[model samples]
Target: MPIINLNGPKLSTAKKKELVKRFTEVASEVIELPEEAIIVEINEMPPENVGVGGELLSEKEDK
Candidate 1:
């Protein structure tokens, strides 16, 4: 089985479902594997758990 792990901020259930579906479809086509043979994992990270330039993501301003 092929595994795809994605780590990022938290997301909605709908978005997660969409991502899994899209990823499975594309991966299946490119790798010639069945959708069921591919595994997609999503790791949701809190802003405080992520950092940027020595600062926590929660403390950084969007510029």
Candidate 2:
């Protein structure tokens, strides 16, 4: 079994579903595993809890 974990900002349910589908296809092809044997987990984080270039995402967005 293959597990794929993705961490990013929150997204719509449709977007999440698309990601899972696309990721599964690519991962299955690359790893030579069946789609049924692959798992995709999406971890979403709030802007306050995520940072970039020494600034919090929320703070940067305020600029």
Candidate 3:
């Protein structure tokens, strides 16, 4: 089984579905694996939980 892990900000259900479909399609094509055998796992986090350049993402948005 091939697992595709994606970690990033949260998204709407529609966007998540699109990402999973697209990722699975491409990965299956390139890796020669069945679409059903490819797994796409998404990990979403709030902006407050993420930091960039020593500043939290939520703080940056407020700036």
Candidate 4:
């Protein structure tokens, strides 16, 4: 089994589904694995819990 872990801000259900589909397709092609054998885990975090450039996402957005 191949596992692909993705961590980022929260996303809508449609977006998540799209990502999963695309990721599975690429993984299957690159790794020579079946789509059923590829696992994609999306870990969502709030803006407060995610940061960029030494600032929290939420804080940066306020600027």
User: What TM-score, over all chains together, does every model reach?
Assistant: 0.89, 0.94, 0.92, 0.91
lDDT minimum window of 10 residues, candidate 3: 1-10
Model 2 misplaced regions, further than 4 Å: none
TM-score of 4: 0.91
Return the candidate ranking by lDDT, descending: 3, 2, 4, 1
What lDDT would each prediction earn against the true structure? Answer: 0.92, 0.95, 0.95, 0.94
- Model 4, 17-61: lDDT tens per residue? 999999999999999989999999999988999888889999997
Can you tell me which runs of candidate 4 are displaced by over 4 Å? none
Query: What tens digits encode model 3's per-residue C-alpha lDDT throughout 1-63?
Result: 799999899899999999999999999999998999999999998999999999999999998
What is the model-wide C-alpha lDDT for candidate 1? Answer: 0.92
Clashing residue pairs for model 4:
none
Model 3 deviation from the true structure expressed as Cα RMSD, one decimal place: 0.8
Q: How high a TM-score does candidate 1 get? A: 0.89
Q: On a 0 to 100 scale, what is the lDDT of residue 11 in model 3?
A: 92
For all predictions, the C-alpha RMSD in Å is: 1.7, 0.7, 0.8, 0.9
Error of 1 at 16 (Å): 0.5
